[model samples]
Target chain A: MNNYWSAIVNNLDPYVPGEQTKLSNVIKLNTNENPYGPSYKVLDAIKNSCNNQLRLYPDPESISLRDQIASLYNLNIDNIFVGNGSDEVLAQSFLAFFQKEKPIIFPDITYSFYKTYCQLFNIAYKTIPLDEYFNIKISDYLPKIHKNYIGGIIFPNPNAPTGINLELTDVEKIISSNKNIVVVIDEAYVDFGSTSAVSLINKYDNLLIVQTFSKSRSLAGLRIGFAIGNKNLINGLIRVKNSFNSYPVDKLASIGAIAAFQDIDYFNFTCNSIIKLRNNLINDMINLGFEVLPSKANFIFAKHNKYDAKIIYEKLKDNNILVRHFNKDRINQYLRISIGIEEHLSQLIYILNKIVNN
Target chain B: MNNYWSAIVNNLDPYVPGEQTKLSNVIKLNTNENPYGPSYKVLDAIKNSCNNQLRLYPDPESISLRDQIASLYNLNIDNIFVGNGSDEVLAQSFLAFFQKEKPIIFPDITYSFYKTYCQLFNIAYKTIPLDEYFNIKISDYLPKIHKNYIGGIIFPNPNAPTGINLELTDVEKIISSNKNIVVVIDEAYVDFGSTSAVSLINKYDNLLIVQTFSKSRSLAGLRIGFAIGNKNLINGLIRVKNSFNSYPVDKLASIGAIAAFQDIDYFNFTCNSIIKLRNNLINDMINLGFEVLPSKANFIFAKHNKYDAKIIYEKLKDNNILVRHFNKDRINQYLRISIGIEEHLSQLIYILNKIVNN
Candidate 1:
């Protein structure tokens, strides 16, 4: 509210990230982080990079790391754009391709940051509501559904909070219909079970797929994320990035993420473990009379038949367990629980059974 | 050139940072990186942080690192704002404070990124030409100098490339006269030899001081920087940062920076060594019949009286050495050479002597 602030600052509705509590021994299943640590190889690589060469600036282009990501996706380095994190990459995308004379569109109940970005960039937006079953309807995004123009479209595959993944076919339909505009597929949780939209990149020049090392790769602390898109689309992001921060990815982060991409066995093992744990947790919640969404992410969205969602969330917190409960419309009774280790989930289910019965 | 890019992207002339060549055995002094590495303690802290905890997201507010920086300046945590690098901080500052009714003003030949930011944010600006001696004249920044409106002011102290430090009293005079507008003093190279405007934070709420770990603290590869200012201005930056990237500083970066701030003795020793080396290098350049600016930074800006600046730059590159040369209108003749180790400088002088004589 300072007078010195720009008018945009006063209007900015900043994004509130999930709680990152530092309390020790808490079952922290709130942020959907991977239960397992990143590959031990990543640690070794980071440790090896901690040398005198740190006196110099990291590569502004992050060429080697981009090359690694390119190899994984069978894309060229020019198709990739890396940043401090996926959040930063998203911000750049909004400025790069979304702002226009017409408003952009997304799921009404998708990642809240999309709306926040709209406010920050003064881009007009309309949120099309999800279907009654909490699924993204490709029909809702058809151009004929709206009379006014649409500048772009963006939604997370295997969406957050609900964790329901839209099939790859629907993703392509949206991209094809929005050929005149940029269609961003935010695949932050894609590695758990959902298919990637990256395969369609060559077919649709306007398709941009953004992913992160935070979820399946388990490198949230290193803060690495990237976008895979057409070379021209990537160049647009690069222009905005070069205008902003020349070196968004630091040396250690680049090295750590490169190692994460290199260890295919470890990556597959960890993602499979999370998917297995997620299924087990879903089954346990269903047995306790909770109705759960069909989740493709590492987290589950569920509501109890008897107990109040907020009360259950509090009880879990009181018992030194943490899960996310969004106090928002149409989803107030649902709790988003991230999958933890087998032992932690066992304790969670045991505690939930007592809370629900009582 | 893409139609999808935001209208601002087309007008943006992005800043071209010095080349980060991958060539080996080159005496790299192009960027003002410290000749020495970060303290051993910093490396140890970073290595220790490479563990399982990296599975979780870093603290979005970066409380611990902010505390360390606040303690260094005898200020509160509310007065400090940390970001990916000084460049990011500078970019945030442009969006947060400078996009006002009137055009902001800076030196025509200052850090070129300032102009790039003005273009990126679509903020109007006027660049006051430096005096014939290449020093930032405080009078030109005085409110009376321009009949039209002035939005704000930002300039690098020990101004970039030229490396001439403006007196603290002059900095205060500009800040005082421009009380209606925010004044930013970028002190990226302040630790080398110049006094910090941090001493003046309490005196003026509109004064914001930006500093970085790249040059003096020897952590360019780590990408840590901070801004010290009034609580309200800091709040403004927080709003913009939260809207953009909630956690610009990653986990390992935060821990590594805290360690760098803790080892004050190492910081001072490295800074003093660079200052001593800079003085010797200046004297050597003067002996070689080159005119050098009165530098107060880790880099020296010099031009030979007879030799063409671009040829010298290329010759040095050919000799397995790298230095910066801007081909802009005013400073085209100057070669900005970073202060490297004694051996690197001796070789520089020997080669320059031969290049000039031969």
Candidate 2:
């Protein structure tokens, strides 16, 4: 440990995102990024933005991008807030709503970043155990059970490393349980599989929905994410964001994200293609003696009882295919694989055939 | 106030950056951005990076960009860290170094964001008053005044709003005084005027130097910034950054920053031109009955004794020009104007002649 680090720094267990390899020709199915490039309109907008105006700072409020998102969601711009990415938005949300007198609650098997954010903000947290099927139990999250030690709750829908989703009715149940306390629903994977909580925002003032352009919009490189909530919740996020960095989204990012939202046809085509491919991939994996979870996300969580997950991960890496394998006790046997293009999935099957069928 | 806001969010006084208008023809001069576009190489690199790989996550460590910066300063890659912008880097430094039991010190009139950061981090700070001549009195920072309440120190070189700079020897004096605590020297404007204390990073473990590409490199649209310091300090920042967001620098930002550094000749040419234009503008302002600071930066802080600064700001806005006028005391009478191209400045002078010389 470094002697100069603050107590907060010493306490932080930094979040480790899935590996992003620099090698060319590797079939990437680790991080759940869309396998397709953004729309031509997005590329054109970004290229057009590369001018002398590159010298000027981007809009701190992200007014244009926020307005575009709000219009798409049938909400007011006051109900929206944009940031560098959903990770940045998620981090800001932890600072804004989750750091409270009582310990916050989240799913133990959800996005690992929740724990990291709690450490960085010095907020106490309790992780309610995910059910045996890797599902969230809404009843277990009631404030009465914790006797007022409940500050708030946050969990990603179509949860990472599990690829299971909570229905809108169940999500609303949790929000309704914590009326006074805030409830954040991270929708990073929502576009691929489920209905957004945007409709629930107007009804529940305590509901905050965080989404990203990184997955479905395929603009991860541009780094844009946003939050949709009531005006007061939006204002709290704005305060935390402005205090952190005024211009988190650069000029090109703002323009590029706005263009992504406008290209509805292209976005729909790519997302649907991933869903079809995901279904086919799951069938193929099950045929190969692996048990795959029912997934609505662009990824699947699968395990084969006969094969060691670590060994398969290593063999795949050696063969130029990368997938995520968590080493934790409960998840060590499972592999979280992102859905790639048709060609990428075919290549992955070919590699698995050589390794597993043997 | 919002009831859901955290104690920190409730306590925040968020920073307000300069206006970013969507108009096509305004002579923008409020934010201190470079008037020139980035080199052709930077543009080509960004275009080349706009491929299907945009779906993949950017390298969280920002290895290539950090390597280039480290080599420029003759330091190890471990000694460097990069972020979305210098604002992000500066914000992280506050969380990394200045959040301690002792109070930090900065000039009362330095970059306004320092105070905002303090409020957000809940760090106690004491602002040392700048002398009547609008200069940083380095000796006033002597540790003898406050026994151990000094957590660290930070101020912009060629200090903001006033555009006055401190010599290298004087900067060393402050660093020497705060030997035990981390001292951050923001060099956001150093490329335009003063020497960077980067070289002193090796001699003193407590010194951290922060710089940004937003100004001199003319890549504000890309949002790239960095810090060079002792390995431990850089490590501390990495922990805080990773805990917050894994990939602060996006893919295009990484590639564009590397291209900007490689085109040394183009970077030098633009910086020199801006310096020359700043000199000419200062002379012109003095001729027009305005008292201007002796500036080594790309901006000049000036006041016309006969005119109100706020009125001038409003008049310029009506005339489709924008310059910054802080409504705070002691500096409310002055205007901070970014040095635009010769055409922009000439047009500004023409408008001022109509308004002031009338």
Candidate 3:
């Protein structure tokens, strides 16, 4: 810790993202990326955009892309706000709407980045524990808001690591009841299984739904994500954004993301494939003596009753397979594995059977 | 003025970038964009990068691009920090090093974004007014650093809107005298003319020089920039960056930036052309009865005593030519014109001659 650093900088415990290992043969599944490629149209659009026009800056407002997103969601242009990624959009939201006299609230076991953001922005936060069955209790969150003031709320629809989704009715109840506080729904994996909160955006002015091309749309490396909310909330974020970085989405990202939205058919097909593979993977794991969570995301959280998770994780690593194993208490027994292609799943099942039987 | 918004959000006056008009025929000379395209190799690299691999997230560390920049600058990898753009890099720098008991200092007549950033980060600042000739007085800056009170210093080299560069010797003197406070030399337009402080990074640990691909490398649309400094300064930026956004640069941007570095010959050729054109354009403006600054950048700052800059700006817009005229009080009389291609400049001169004669 250097004395020259800011007080906030010293206090930050930055989130460590998954390892981006360059190994050619490793069975990679840690980061829950779609195994399928982005649409051919996205690549074509990116190639077309690589011209002398790149000498100029991209549209600071990203108007055309926002229009396309608005059209897809049946919302007005004022409802949309885009950024470098959903991470950036979320970061801006925390700065714009989450910092207040009161503490923000979220699930105790949710996206780890929410806590990281709180540390960065110095936003006070309280994590309400989920139920004994690892389900989010809307009742628990509702009463806490009355007891202690809440600035905002955020939880992934089909939550990460656990991969279980809260029903849409439950989400609507929480959002409608908490009209005074901003409610952010991160739909990074919504396209895989659960319904999007975008339809509810018109009804709930305080509701802000954040989505990313990184997951179901398969454009993680392009760095594009956006939020749909009421015009007032979008304007608030745009103000913070314009103050921070005028042009967050680069030209290539803008063109590619717009094209990704245009190719709706391709998006649906790819997400359907992932959902089908997810079900098959779950069955295979259960047959191999592993207990799997009811997953709505692209990845599964599971643990074998007989074998130690850390040991199993190490054994898989030795065989050139990579999966995420959290060492934190209460969740150390489970490993989060992303759904890969059919061939990758077959290989994973083969390896797991060998290890479990031994 | 929503009640749910952050208190700081309501107080912000966001920076307004120069207009990027979508009109095609306008001789765009507002932002200091390179008059030529990036190297063919750069485009090719981006094309090659836009593949199925986009499914996975880019390297959060961006090690390959960092190593490429480090090799080009003859510095260790630890001395380099890359970001979405120099704007983002500067924003991070303000958060990382520009906070202390004392106020940060900058020229009164300089990049307006400096003040905007100060406001965004809530950084206390004291403006050191430029002299009558619009030159920063090093003496005024040096005397104020007693008691180790100044948090940091930042100014554009060949300062924007004036285009007069601080001598490298003078910069070294300041760096030597102010070893305790961080001194940032923003070299966004350094590649067009003048020497760089990057060579002195090893000798002065307190110096951090920021540069951008937007001006000289013609990658504004790609949104890439970097900072060169001592390891300690770079490490501080990395900590803030990781907490903020892990993957600021996308796949295509990284590949294109690396390729731009590789094609040194192409880079030199394009920059030389812009320099030659800039000299010619400045000479022509003086001949047409204009008071021009001694420019050491890709643009020139000039004013015609006979013509109100705003009126002239409006007339130029009518003639399908666009130039920047700041509404700020001090710089209101001036028109900041970016050096464009030879054909574009010839047409602009022709239009100016007609306007002046009439």
Candidate 4:
């Protein structure tokens, strides 16, 4: 728009993230955030790191944190890379492995940030449309294999906005058949229900699994995420990261993430509670004549055939409650609602029933 | 090199930062770290922020922290851009402003990261070598300017490794003459003893000043930095940032940085102490038959005409005292020693006397 801007800057249509409303009383279900707080041990670890030692730079390699992650996932330190968030880890992956002579392929309806990253990096991409049932057809990806091309795939285990998970066997088949390409399984919400592909990483050198602490770990504000992959692929990402920024994780973030891994009991308890709440919420919605999809994430995607989705989103907003509604074409009719605490979900269902009856 | 990595990754020779040793008794002087600890209020603020609220994501826009930075610099909020560190800020600037038809220009021996960033972004650059005395010759930059060439310019104000600062008038002359090209002044160590160019931000639209809390505010472990420039330029960076990662600064880092700005007395006192110790150390080195450069930053660059620089460095390291020595061609004779506390410097001087006398 301006003379001082770069050519790519003017062409970029940046992704608009879900609204983070600051109103204290609003029932915020817009972003898929965990309702429970982080474990007490996470707070203590952060406190322990915030002493007088903050004057010096943190470990540039993030060795201790990486070692902890490697142990938790049963992978070596050489097979893992950490960043400020999963988004950053994805951005580095795109630059490291996705840019090729031919276009990469991904589902048409997917995380919006992936397209935005392609635009920023000038990577050519082709959008393969999902089937009528909103499921990714694996056959569509097989045809795009070419000599000059590189494959970069990222679909949430329980995909975002739609909250439908692909079976772990299907994922394994895709990686095995397309041995020449790289397949990334984003497990941001996998802790809720879906199976993780992390266990299959050793079998497939082209498989890269991304996970975050924002959702199930309940440390979204701390900004930590990681990628588990083959040692060579992990080394490529480290090269890109070292060339870009040395210290991506701060003192508090590193300490809090390490402690989050240490407290396995708290993590299991909180994630289990969310899954239970999600199933109950789905039952309530279906009984009320809402078309809810099969969900395995911390959120559910649903629509009322009689009520317009935009109208429902606005009404909820007016009542000081927030839910996600997309303006994009194929998914605009649906609403993505996050699973909150018991009291918050009860309030949402009661209000929804009244609105539908009226 | 791996078969899956992009072609660009294979060509990159990434920058290697100075070592961060974990020895307890060593007087660490390799990287230019602040000798004193961060403010007590910064530690308190970080502790206060590590709570249940971490279950939610931080403000992606970082509005409050930007407001604090704007208020301190007497600039509008739109003119400020923040990143994980000055290194990231500089990298973004290279992608946003320096990828023009002509190559960018920088000192051949300035911040080593500048060359590394150029390679990472695939930007063409021509290094304007410093004069024989290791000073940035303004005349060299003026003569090389042409219409279809010269994207921008960047160098540390108090040039790194040399610890010398350019006059404000000389910098302004460069800005006025090269009105079409962007000029970035990296003032990472300016707060130690030199003046700042933040006051001239309103006068020149093409000028961008980058600074960090790592050197001045003593919060390096927290990873925070900012760029002050025209609003249009800042917005260009925001587009790139949004495409990459939304929340580069985490919740605790934002809160800790704000507290750092609030404690003006602590910041000023620490900087003053470092300045005094630096001057005393320089005098003592000269008295001991070493040639020390006139420094405006926290570190001193010195070498002895009688002894081998590498020998002296190895001797100091053997005694558990660390300092930075570059193996590069031009600066192989000098050692960059950070100014620590008075007692640390006294010990260093005693060891130096023994080495020289022996």
TM-scores of the candidates are 0.99, 0.98, 0.98, 0.98
**Clashes per candidate (backbone, < 3 Å):** 0, 1, 0, 0
State which candidate has the highest lDDT. 1
Q: What is the TM-score of candidate 1?
A: 0.99
Candidate 1 lDDT, tens digit per residue, A257-320? 9999999999999899888998989998999999999999999999999888999999999999
Taken over the whole model, the C-alpha lDDT of each candidate is: 0.93, 0.89, 0.90, 0.88
Report lDDT (Cα) of residue A188, candidate 3: 90
Candidate 2 lDDT, A1-358, residue by residue in tens: 6655677898789999888788888999999999999998998888887776777787788889999999998999999999989999999999999888899998888889999989988889999888898888877877667665788889888787788988998999889888889999999999887777788998999999999999999988878899999999999999988888888998888888999999999999999999999999999999888999889899999998689999999999999999999989688899999999999999998988888899
What lDDT does candidate 2 reach at residue A155? 88
B15-65, model 3: which lDDT tens digit per residue?
888898888888999988888988899998898888999989999988999
Q: What digit string (tens of lDDT, one per residue) describes model 4 on residues A253-338?
A: 99999999999999999999999999999999998889998999999999997999999999989888899999888888899999
- TM-scores for chain B, in order? 0.99, 0.98, 0.98, 0.98
**Per-residue lDDT of candidate 1, residues B1-358 (tens digit):** 7887878887789988888988878999999999999999999999999998999999999999999999989999999999999999999999999989999999988898998898888899999999999988888888678653898999999999899999999999999998889999999999988989999999899999999988888999989899999999999999999999888999998999999999999999999999999999999999998999999999999999998899999999999999999999988999999999999999999999899988
lDDT of 3 by residue, A140-221 (tens): 6685545647788888898877899988999999898888889999999898889888879989988999999999989999
**Winner by DockQ:** 1
Q: Over 4 Å off in model 4, which ranges?
A: A143-150, B143-148
Tens-digit lDDT track of model 4 for B1-358: 7777878888888878778877789888888889999999999888887899999998888888889999998999999999888888888888888877778888988889888788888888989888888888987667454443688888898999899888888888777777788889999999888888888899998899999988989888988989999998899889889988888888888898889988999988999999989999999999988999889999999999798889999999998889999998888989999998888889899999999988
Ten residues in sequence with the least summed lDDT for candidate 1 chain B: B140-149
For candidate 4, the docking band is high
